[model samples]
Target: MSPRSGLQREVLSLYRRALRMVRTKPPSTRAKFLLFVRYSFHRNATTISPRQVSVIEHLMRQGRKQIEMYEDPSVKDCWVSKEMKEWNERT
Candidate 1:
């Protein structure tokens, strides 16, 4: 197989970081958190146009910020609940 592109590497790194952060969550909520992450990435999979480099970079930055925010212990307390709630509302 061929090597991954830079954008692909960045996307994978962000996904890995997000999953790593999920470990910090409570066990009871870990599965839900993982589902949320998977759903989020999958939802955007088709929305990222190959020609839009700027849009891809912007999404990467947003993903990084999301991971950072979730990593903060103070925010971690309500992160899953709030996110799941929002996800529920959206659906």
Candidate 2:
């Protein structure tokens, strides 16, 4: 919920931890995953270009809506691309 106040690496570490927690849970999985997704999209929202945070937020609010979209491996890769690279480079 709070903006990342730490260094970039620390911020990314926190983000990954948050995502892992979300993915491992049951009831909180959706909410936490949505939070992670929203945070990712909005990380540079203030300083960077416009993104679909509103849509992501909306989807997060509505549980399991468009849930089938995750079945596509491409989206999953997009999400993990940065993690896989271990850099701050865009996914």
Question: Which pairs of residues clash in candidate 2, taking residues 3 or more apart in a chain or in different chains?
Answer: none
Worst 10 residues of 1 by lDDT: 75-84
lDDT of each: 0.78, 0.44
TM-score between candidate 1 and the true structure:
0.77
Give all TM-scores, in the order shown: 0.77, 0.32
The best candidate by lDDT is 1
| Candidate with the greatest TM-score versus the true structure | 1
Steric collisions counted per model: 0, 0
Residue 72 of candidate 2: its Cα lDDT? 38
Q: The CA-based lDDT of model 1 is what?
A: 0.78
Write one digit per residue (lDDT tens) for candidate 1, span 1-91.
Answer: 9998999898999999889988998887777778778767866777778678898888889889977988886654434456655766676
Deviation from truth (RMSD, Å), model 1: 3.9
Candidate 2 wrongly placed segments (more than 4 Å): 1-6, 27-32, 40-91
